[model samples]
Target chain A: MDFSSKLLEQAVLEMSQLPGIGKRTALRLVLHLLKQPEMQTLQLTDALSNLRTQIKLCKNCHNISDTDLCEICANPTRVKEIVCVVEDIRDVMAIENTGQYRGLYHVLGGKISPMDGIGPSQLKIKSLIDKVREGEIEEIIFALSSTLEGDTTNFYIFKQLEGLEIKTSTIARGISVGDELEYADEVTLGRSIANRVPFESSLKS
Target chain B: MDFSSKLLEQAVLEMSQLPGIGKRTALRLVLHLLKQPEMQTLQLTDALSNLRTQIKLCKNCHNISDTDLCEICANPTRVKEIVCVVEDIRDVMAIENTGQYRGLYHVLGGKISPMDGIGPSQLKIKSLIDKVREGEIEEIIFALSSTLEGDTTNFYIFKQLEGLEIKTSTIARGISVGDELEYADEVTLGRSIANRVPFESSLKS
Candidate 1:
């Protein structure tokens, strides 16, 4: 297709920047948007503009929010004594969808990665430490990924929480929910129960 | 994740309205947008908004343009005598990309879909007829799809061009390039060449 119109070309350029989307796909999407009613297309444009302009980081947890406090932080029913420390809000949502954790969230923003110029200072680690130091939290759960950076971040946090009696734990990794015990692959099933913990004393010395 | 943030929710909602995009994909895209640089995301938003604000249809050919006449229409090298009639600008672009034609184009805006309440009045058929009546055109090629509505629209245009000596033809569909010619099915290849004729005979009788 002729990429003539600057706005059309720009839309394609912007869309191509997205993962897995190329210039051709972006062009198709732009053309598709052109055919749609004005409101729908304008809404998408407004939504994109607002995604950056309107959304702010929650002061308490750093989860995306419009105000200083995210809904999770402002909620009274959520258990504040049990803090779930996650590398990102995505992890927080992943845990929350289980309907299992009623605890408050602590968004680290990112895992500590020294090689990539990302350190604890880059993340919201100081804020998390300050939240924990208030002494109201009873448990601090680590819900970082199984990556190397996740391990290092966990250790760093544990070191920082040195003098605290708060219970430290992590979510299990092997197998998954609704797994068939009989049909389970040997390594997967064996590792699932093997790595299973009591959720209280696990990840502790 | 809970789609609670107004901007995030709006982004998701807008994404969901796109063709082939569902709620899950919308959420994924919105979340992906969040990971991109703030400036990059804003560029896309601005581009989309600019498309509506800045882009306009060419008054002559009805093709999408940033000005009164599209670049294709303004290009002196393009053969105005061989005007390719398409259902939309997308069709015009597809032909342009083929690099096989050096002709001007006329966008019909849309096809006649009575079921969807689209009729001759909804399309740019009147504009096309008026342009053809000027008698400068030698060949008026039909580059619409072979779909039911596309054929219907083509037939309608063919009738309008009746007694006007301008030849009307269509883009030939064949086994794609790079496809194994030796392994090629003779029937499809034969049909391809047979269907392709000089612009005159296809429309005349």
Candidate 2:
């Protein structure tokens, strides 16, 4: 299309590469950004750039962070003896929003999907086991989704933690299912977290 | 709801300020951007900043450009005698995409509307009239949306050019209404442009 100078087209092309953004929407966004003050666009661009450059996986919990340890892990008030494990940073944000849980978080990065060639080793599972093996973590609450992959990942973690004195439990799956932690409103997610079931208790006294 | 990390929340707030973006979509977008490299975010931020600071509205057509005269206005081959008047830069893009027209353009900035307190005086209408008085222009095509406001603006321009011994016309109404030109596909818009009619040709002797 005969558009104004090539810069407009360049901005649109870059935006269109983002997930869920189509060409039309991208163009509209570029135009809208053009209408904004230069500072706002610069801030957004810097944030996106920092998301990749300044960020690295937290060695403790595997969450994206500006430092070796995520802000959640670096905080002093957070519970150090209990780590809530989840599939991604979005999940961490969902749990954090509730303000009901005070423990630190472990971002698994993603679930184990055999078809996608993902398995226990591909994720931060080894680091998770190491964290638990250090013996300070008294309880581990699993907040993964209830999809088949979620269950598989959970059980794998459960098996890996076997015979360890540390208590292990999976966050209740009653309110959430499939790849939907992103959509589970706070109340439902909180309820599930409160009702977490101990893996050892399920086997009997 | 009590959210952690004010920066992430701020990002969502700013994204939702866009014309069509909503809260959930903005959240998804922020998170997606977070997953990208810092360089990408920086580029977007830089582009946005540059979009406002470095870019200026072209002095002639009012199409956005980095210079006083946009690339379109500065180009020599485009026929200066035929001025295709459009409502905004988006229309300029639409006409350019077809690669059919070889005329210079005049972006009216917006159509006239008294209800919004925008009138012929508020727009670049004076500039348009000045062009007509110069006596070199043979045809002025109103490639604006066909609507009450568009037609109203067209009539206002037609009246301004009264007895100038020049041709004044409007883009066809077969495919446009109420500023819906932004949503129209290229083919329909192109056809409408090709089938335009003179404003008062039917009334003239």
Candidate 3:
């Protein structure tokens, strides 16, 4: 770890500060950058700095955006009345990739995890509640993970919307498309059986 | 892979360009950075850009440095006559970490790899030969890796120094200190047997 230059050491230290990168990996990455043209390093640095300083969050849904409104929230074709709620931007991207749903999104930023000190106040729950209270949203879909924290967040929000004139539902749980029936968890298998669709309706997809 | 914003996409693309980082990992890293304070990203970007643009190579040893001469070559206590020739700065650091060698170093930048179109001219070999021709170097130790490329580079340099007055040697190859003999590779085990050292010399360390 004895670097030849202070600049190299500083670079490695900063790089290793990233979540999963260690000092050795940081050193390797920095050395790789050193081997490339200066333009590559400049480009990388510029992108990172620009992202940190100039990136904006959507006012409506709390998703990262280049403007006040995100693409999904701004799109006229997307259903404004049907909002799918999820944790973080990755889920939004995942749902967007499916091309199956045309609804808007409300990113919670994170679920309610008391172990991690995150609660409703730390998320975008208030803004979502405000949007629903404005009486425009007709249905709210809970598309969060099936973890304990996810359920806790969903229940917390559901309690807040007790008298609101909106329908709320969770995404369906079942065995994955290619999974064997025997391998499916008991809870999922039971739910899949209870929520079984009519034989003709299953042919729509 | 449809990004919500152009800036996010650009940052992820640049990050994924790094070795061992894929698009998914790049997205994760970028998102982690986004969640942190802007100052952290600015510091990292500054360090990277500075390291790439301002770093220098030592004139004497061709190792990375902040000045004209590297620390090892600049030190008056290090033996100037005895030089350990290595493939790159990493080897120099590795040998320095051992705390056994007190000699100067000559970094070749890279080995002579014909398959990769790398030749002596592409490396610091000519400067090494020039140093030997200067008649100041008394001994040159080859500390390159145990690969075919390493051997080809060593042999090529050895041929050039055939008529020189300097003594030439290579680092000893044997079983690693903590490794079991039964698990040792055949080539290394055979060489260890063929070049067995005196029992008293083995006990010196």
TM-score of each: 0.84, 0.76, 0.97
Runs off by more than 4 Å, candidate 1: A112-117, A182-187, A195-205, B35-37, B113-117, B182-187, B193-205
For model 3 the TM-score comes to 0.97
- Give the whole-model CA lDDT for all candidates, comma-separated: 0.81, 0.78, 0.93
The sequence of per-residue lDDT tens digits that candidate 3 reaches over residues A14-106 is 999999999989988998998889999999999999999999999999899999999889999888899999998999999888889999999
Ranking by DockQ: 3, 1, 2
The better-scoring model by TM-score among 1 and 3 is 3
Residue range B1-205, candidate 2, lDDT tens digits: 3334455556667777777888778778877777666666666665556565677788877788877899888999889899998888888888888777899888887889889788887788888888889887999998888679988988888888898889876655456446588888887788877876687983653
Residue B83, candidate 3: Cα error in Å is 1.4
- CAPRI quality level assigned to candidate 1 from its DockQ score: medium
Each predicted complex: what DockQ?
0.55, 0.37, 0.92
Distance from true location, Cα of B1 in model 3, Å: 1.2
Q: Write the per-residue lDDT of candidate 2 for residues A1-205, one digit (tens) a residue.
A: 4556667766776777778898788888888777557767766665455444555677888776657777888999999999898998778878887677899888887899999899887888998888888888999999998789998998999989998888877765555336478778787788778887788975762
Clashing pairs in 3: none
In candidate 1 chain A, where is summed lDDT lowest over 10 consecutive residues?
A196-205
In candidate 2, stretches whose alpha carbon ends up further than 4 angstroms from where it belongs are A46-59, A64-78, A114-122, A175-205, B1-3, B113-122, B175-205
RMSD of each: 5.1, 7.6, 1.4
